[model samples]
Target: MPKVSRIIPILENLLFFWLGLALVLSLAGDSLNIPSLLQVLGRAHPLILHFPIVLLLMAVAMLWIKDEKIKEIGTWVLLLGANLTGLTVLAGLLLANEDYDGAMLFWHQWLGVASLGLSVLIYFYRDKSSSFLKISTGALAVAIVLTGHFGADLTHGENFLLTPIQSNEEEFVALDDAEVFQHMVKPILEAKCISCHKEGKVKGELRMDDLAGLQKGGKNGPFVVPGDLKESLLIQRIHLPEDSKEHMPPKNKAQLTDEELEILQLWVESGSSFEQKVTELESEEPLFQLASNKFSNQKSYTFDAASDSDISELNNFFRKVNPVFPGSPALEVAYYGTSAFDPTSLKDLKSIKEQVVKMNLNRMPLESVDLSFLRDFQNLEELQMNFTGVTPNQLSNLEGLENLRNLAISGNSLGAEAVSVLEKLTQVKKIFLWNSGLDESSKENLRKALTTAHIDFGFDGKGIIYALNPPKITFDKELFQDSMELVLSHPIRTAEIRYTLDGTEPDSISSPVYTAPIWLKKTAQIRAKAFAADWTGSLTVSDLLFKSGIQPESYRLAFEPNTKYKAKGAASLFDGIKGKTGHGSGNWLGFKDTSMELEIFIAENTSPNEISISLLLNEIAYIFPPENVEIWTGNQQGWQKLPNTDNAQSTKIEEVRFGMLTFPLPETDFDKVKIRLRPISKLPAWHPGAGAKGWVFVDEILLN
Candidate 1:
């Protein structure tokens, strides 16, 4: 034991010496490649760190043990602990050489090394050196705690453990009024970057805790060169590929999304101003509206005061009256839940006449006579009376509402003369009129009457409204051998079709204009959406087409398909059209509560290496993968199961995913091939709708 004790001190001195050398090497290690062995050992720093923590704490506990034998045992344990602490510190040093925030690494690293050195010293002089032991023990305890704290912060986030309790609710800011830098951009930086780039934790000497520090830059210099994202190092680092070693937030850390990156880029392009408001950007600009929606805060009004009792009294089952926001004095009165709304409900709201500033009487069964009560709501800024039986004369009642900024009466039986009355309200900014009985010429005249107000003809309506309808993707045939041509058409001839070939939904600006027939050569998903300059964009319609490049002359199904989902004879299986995800799309062949057996005959005797079958899985709809699939070959024994391939079956139950499952076949020449698909008898307990019948949805089965 004495010899072991003497050898431990020698080992401790060697570790202390190596630590000093490592500290010097780490200064330049960020750019240089270390030995692969050291790098491999460094990867274990996270798992190895806890050992020293437990040992050091146990050593501290040993100090309080009154027995002499226990004290001797404690000394031996301390010696073993000193060796472990040194090894942990060495591993940590190797880890520190890799990419990590330097400021965050500094204190934890040095303190850990110091604690190990103290442990070694205390182990040697526990009996003979009382004063040294007493001083070093307290210092070691503090050093270990602080080192662990910073280490925890490095692994998680700064104050991660404390965040749950320390977090306090912050005040909300409206998107239009919010400062671009303070509310939108800075918060993103603080959450994602500031932990590594803040004051004490400034990795690369870049402090992002304050605007001034960001302006001053770090070791590489200015983070932003105002209006030049290309020149800005901050933007450059953020835009780096997430897999890249130089990427901001580093590997495995939470990353900034495309939207957040766009917002950052927009702020930089707008001169990186701290005080710029979202309202300053025009509503027509894409980023302006995008940022406006992003920063929108839904909170109670903070203005003086609406009577809650009065507002409550004005509300009923069909009609509701409340503050525009939580604490605002301005009230919003709306009617809902009734298919046939009674216009007389407007009379009850007269009690909160001074408070009401927005009234939504959408789908109300109102006429010219019912609108007479609206003149009392002089403070009303927004009025929605869409789908009402209102006429031209009824609009005159709203002329008294000078504060009205938005007036929506789109689905009424009003003429252009009704919109002309809006000219009297000088403050009106927008007027909706798609379904009103106004002609094109009358609409032009109405636009001239209200020159300041934007005439909205329900141009952006999404749901089942009368003005705009979704586009249909028409094709000669969904399945084709070599290629398929797609045509996009809408009910309204004037609508333009915009499409994306990458399976993502088409947007107005980003999607390509579909002028000609889109030809597909390989398996591709085409998504097309319709839009008009003066009408709302349509919902996307998607179609997946397959190009197997091979043809089968004949095929047979062992069992008949359900009457509701039968394909056109046996040729449907060989057809190169891929089915969509849903069951109702009619592209799928669903076999409910039954297994599938199929045999295909080709004109030529070709020995194909593999065959792939397209299958759909939507557990909610009880569509599941086949329990087992078997392939048979025509040999001397007539038919036999093919040799099992290397592909392993997945035991995991996942969400809806349409996939092409490939099965390897034996190299044998046969004109005919048979496939047997076995479906699950019942849904698993993990499924939401458990104990239900399992279905197998198969589309195109292609031999390659």
Candidate 2:
């Protein structure tokens, strides 16, 4: 036994030497990558730290022991405590340099080192300095307590033990008086970010402890930008993948809750203000809910459990009975269909009599007296019997359901007398009585009877303007050689449709009235809208009509149309019958931002006096007019550029157009001709999608 005692002191000195070596190695943590074996061993610090605390506590109690046998055992325990303390400190320093922030590491590490030194001091000087042993043991116990507390704080959160003991009686600021950045955003950053981002332990050279530090940002950039949440680094880091090294709070630290993330997003979205009240924002904003929760005094309730057999029997094909939540006693009952309702089937639900909390019997054939069975459901909180045969006399049956919060009995024979009985429920919050044979005076009287409950009797049809459906463009053929017939009609029959032909939206008064079919000779636009008396104007509809000039003998395209929009064959372009007005029509050929190049061969070589190119324009459909048009004729001078040609012009009019331009041919004979139409690279600034490339829609290239 004494040989074991002599070996332990040598072991203690070796452990102390190892602890100093590990402390020195940890200083180079920034440059050195710990070996896999040492990293695994270093992780045991948390599990091994408690050993020294418990052993040293037991040794400290032995300082007052009078028995020689116990004293001898105490000496061995104290020596072992000193030995273990050195090993624990070595492991802790290695773990700290691995991933832990060093802001709070100084105090915890030094206190642990002090405890190890005192353990050795008390062991060697217990007999020589009795007074010194007592003082060192007392100091070591307090150091162990504080070291454990700071270790817990690092693992959990700062002052975690005091969090639950915090008083709830403290007054909270209202949403109207609270500052958005100060009250809502700062606390979240302090809890989840400040540990790594503060002064001494700035992991990314960022500090979130103060506004200036946050705005000054890190090596990357500013943590938050006033109005741009997506550009803000604070938001960018939080939304990063959890396994990512850049993710905030690190994977090992405490992560922000969903509500906390939303609060930060809302704060940055609201200009990252320091003094703006949450209530000052729009009511639909999420900040109002976050701020309100800070002052809410809401509570949750528990219910009794229901039997499993009773739950199974109460549920059937015609009715459904299920718990509000998992393992909750509160159950909701709803009927499947109106015809599936059987009065006798109500007896089957008697098994779950006390567990049922809600009953939905809407659109059922329930009679007034059928509700008498509701007396068995004392726990019922909501009863929906809309469009049922419930009469005014049956309203008394629901008085026993004191827990009822909502009663929807619309489309029934209920009146003021029936509503009078519900005022006694006290807990009832809302009574929906839409179209229950209640007059305006009866509804006003019911509202007076129950000040707490809201009585809804629907609304009178007054001052309401119903929207009219968009007018439909009716036509036989939009593409024609000479002319085409275009008609505009509304389904309302009596609605008057006004139209335009110059690629402009039609007005109710100034635009031409569409009483008959419009004759379109040249390629033109047809825009129309419907209007009716006592109704809002309908949406405008536009159609394009391209005039087919001389048909080509043979033609070839440069690129194939997208498969989704390739409606008709290439010959459909020269069919003389115009394509349908809408882009969905098979006759219309769609091309992306690229140019449409076409080579035409005149079967009979002749002198063509005139040449015209037809194209479609509808910016709302992302189809813009060509940027430029080029035409070439194959002559004795082989593929010569045609001079002085008119190009199709684009309009700022927010409507559809079938544009055509004619280029006169000189006294020259040509067997082959080529045409190129370049689509607009980018849409005009007037368009909603201004910066995007515009599509080119064309059905035919007319030649004469």
Candidate 3:
């Protein structure tokens, strides 16, 4: 009781001081130059405000307790709540000195002060009648709730609470009909830039919620200058280093994606017109391709959905019958595994012919199968028979497909006879007859006959030299106990696979031609490329094969991975499942601005010679290799530090790639191994996110 008496007086004095400070700060408003220390303390308002909300709500609930001992405890709770409420209101007042405005902020500030004042009143009148205390506490609770609601609106944008129930359904706009600004540029801004620059919390006096405000600009100039990217404020900010104060979005906010940035640049370059339709731009322009990709051309189908049981029954290992998209009635049937394909597989889809809008028989053995089964699919819009052994006679079966808009018969041995059958299909807008034994003269005749349809005789390999795709490299295992077989093959059978054993680029003349799988006895870096007689040499593709001397029994991570890219948890590192290039593929363990520390437990009598960590680098996405890596081997008694490796910081943006960091370990027996990976503390000055922490992504860790 004596301790409570002393604390209450001190708390009351502190509460009075906070109340006065808050009033002064609130009155000072935007005119006040908040100190650096005060700004840091103000930012902690979000963290501290929650405590008072929970405590004050609990204190209000306690007013109903009839027990004398509980009532005595309620007094202490009310005093603590009042003191905290004053502090919270003061913090909020200081935070409001930032670029916060609008009705939401206005209401949140007043209501927070009202709640604090009411809490103090409730504390002072604790000895009053139960009814009076209950009434006062109830009003204070209502004020707190309102204050929190508006505060949320200020921080998370308007209607944050109602967002879950709100419909986010996007209207499907056709590619040709989509407006350049409304359909493309507006959406990008809404997703990446609008949250911070919206009405209530305009970061730089720039309101991006509407077009007029964008034209008005912020403290700078206009947001965009049509046909002048150099003068455009939006482009300038977007191109600025991510850590720059003038950047469109702060480093902490979601940045503009590569595609989005490209689109904006193209839009400005093409004269940023708000009313320009996608078709207004030249068809060959890059903006048109981007717009075509951004907007869906799919028309709503009127056909009834196929029965689930029928779809399920039709789907097999070789044949797949599924909707083109979720909740779509239109079905797309694809045939895979040429050996398992049967003529009956095509006939089996008769039950749902009306719903089958697209059919892909690419590379299937269609010589024996009757393609006449396709005539039954009256609603079919696209039919692909690429390299499917389709004959000129088989092409006649597609004549009656009135709804067919796209027809692909690439790699077929079709002649002039097939052109006649195609000319009859008047509804077909696009016809792909690439490598379909139709001579240039016949293709020209077909193009003349079908004036409305586009006859694409793809890539006449005459004078133009095309580069061969990189050879596909595969290994039996990346982390092997003794040796691993590395196989290299190219898609074009005529192309020769050239590779290098060392970490040098493979050349057509000097590199060894790959025939049989190469057996790698130790850790090696393989670089391979495809080379053909006429085609240009392909870009080099590389992979690191690690030789493991010891396999760890178990492993543990010091920190949990980022929630967005946790993959399969800590087990993912040793699971031998290498993540693809993209981080969103759910294979890589992503850490943002944090070091990765892993401990591996080795079995008895296994002394590993090396440790290899595979890392992903996508500089444009801000994912970089580790700045430095440290390795430690130890038992229960002590630990020994191994020679560490440091990575040179990248200066230019590169394509998404994978790199291996190998650490040579001393030949000493140890039961445990600890690896520490420190990500780049700050991105390079040449990079967009200069001065911001880079990301480190890892999928596999090998102990050799």
Candidate 4:
């Protein structure tokens, strides 16, 4: 009893102190400067708030109990609840300073303070008349409920409580009348992004609530560049690895599904027009097909759902069977792992054949499999067999699929006999025959035979000439002791890959064609491009290959890298695996506000002629090139410094790329080599985080 008396006064004093602070902060509003530490604590408001709510409700419930012991326990619970209420209100006040304002925030703030005041009143009046105590407790409960209601609105957006009851079915718009942006693009943004980027909470200064705000993009650049997916900030952020800091929708927020991302990319690729209608695009275009699938009246399935055990038993690393949507009886089955595919795997799906509405057999070796297994899937609406070994004789088996509306058989060699077999599948509304060995004459014959169906031959190259994508150049190792074979390839099989090793641009007429992997004996820069007979040549791509003189026995770092980016410690620099652009990739060793010092030890009789350091530059992420590099050679006695090289400062932001800094070493034999790389002490004024320390990312080091 004595200890309780002493603690009561202390808690009362703390409650009053917090109450006064909350009042001051509420009045100061946006004028006060909040420290970063307090801002972090404010973020914890969501976590700490539930305690007071439950405690106060429990105290109110206990007060109604007739037992005397229960009333005594209620008094102590009331005291704890009142104090926590004050603390919660204070934390909420601090959190409101994060540019959060609206009617919802305003009401939630005042109601929370009102709840705190009423809780204190009920706590101090425990000894008074029962009627007065009842009134106060009732008011406190009502205040807490209202406060929580508005708080949920502020955090999750308005009408969050009623979202389950709200109609989710999109209103049907006729395909000819639907505007591409209005019916397709805007709804995706509203559902996925507008909660944080709307008027009440504008994260990154970007707003998605209106078309005008989208046109006037935020701090970085334009949200959408017409007909340019690569330059659009919206596309770029979405394409980033989900772990990257710049990834859209944040890690905790709802993410864009694959279909949603494809829609956005298709919209951007087709000029990103606000007023373009679905009828304006060609019927064969992917965007038009997506619009048709979204806006057209969907078919209703009558099949019963497959048993859970049957569905579970069919799933493995090589095959997956899932419902077309949540709670839907219709199933979509897909097969993967070409090497793991078995003909019996298709037979195993017979248990769920009635419910199977879609099946993807792309890239599977289906030539030997008895495709008669598909005739049983009468409910199948879509089938994808692209790049498979499906023959015309096998395709004839699909005539029994009465409900198959979409059929994709691209990348297969189909002769004229395939046209008669496809014409029998009268229910198939869309047919994809790209690279299917069907010439223009055959395609014309099929079109005339099946006038009701839409046939897509895929990019006729009539008036459009696409620039081929850059060829991919890969090698076994960047630093080779003796020799390495460098390989070049392109996605278009007919495209010719041309290469050059003299650091000059590769042209189709003069450069050597890459028929076989070129063997590299010495250090050289390999530049390559892809060219086809009809399409324009692709942009040149280049990579450096270093001829290593001697392999290092071991290496060690003078200081450890940042804890988050410390990949494999000192071993990462010699692992021969290059880190990708993002820092989240575990192959990089990142240093911030510090220098990178490495000591490499070689064999006793080895002499190195040159050294190469591979570094990553992502200016948008504040990873800059090293300010200066110094080389030192050491024997058993001491170290000797060589001529140092200072790098040029970055003048503008650039895409993520890797650069090699090679230094020529004098003729000398040394057992140990020390290299120092100094990161930029302060970021330039034009950068987003100006005056802040920059980062240095090193993935590998080579000795030649």
Best by lDDT: 4
lDDT of 2 at 656: 39
Weakest lDDT window of 10 consecutive positions for candidate 4? 295-304
Predictions in order: lDDT: 0.71, 0.72, 0.81, 0.83
On a 0 to 100 scale, what is the lDDT of residue 571 in model 2? 71
TM-score of each: 0.45, 0.40, 0.51, 0.58
Evaluated at residue 298, the lDDT of candidate 2 is 24
Name every residue pair that clashes in candidate 1: 300-326, 300-327, 301-325, 301-326, 301-327, 301-328, 459-536
Model 2 spans with C-alpha error above 4 angstroms: 1-6, 15-43, 98-103, 168-171, 190-207, 218-221, 241-258, 279-704
RMSD of each: 15.2, 17.3, 11.7, 11.6
User: What TM value does model 3 have?
Assistant: 0.51
Roughly what TM-score does model 1 have, to 2 decimal places? 0.45
The lDDT, on a scale of 0 to 1, for candidate 3 is 0.81
- Which number leads on TM-score? 4
- Residues 1-704 of candidate 2: C-alpha lDDT, one tens digit per residue: 79986897697677567556655655665567667787777789888887878888988887667777877777778777778888888777767665455556777777877777777777778788767777888998999998888777666556756878888474455443466777788878877887666543456667666567787878877788897754577876775434446767687888777678778877877788776766566665768777877743221236567788878877778888888666667788889788777878877777777888888988888773466878888888789989988876677788878778789998988766665675666667778888888777777777777887666678776978887988989776666667778877777999999988876888888988888888887766678899989988987877766666666678887777655355564675676655444555566777774577878887666566667655666654566777777888875568878774555455553333565556766667787788777777886776544676666666766665
Tens digit of per-residue lDDT, candidate 1, span 88-163 = 8878877776546546678877788778767867776777665666677778889999998888787666776688
* Candidate 3: residue 56 Cα off by (Å): 7.7
Count: clashes, candidate 4: 0
> If ranked by TM-score, best first, what sequence of candidates would result?
4, 3, 1, 2
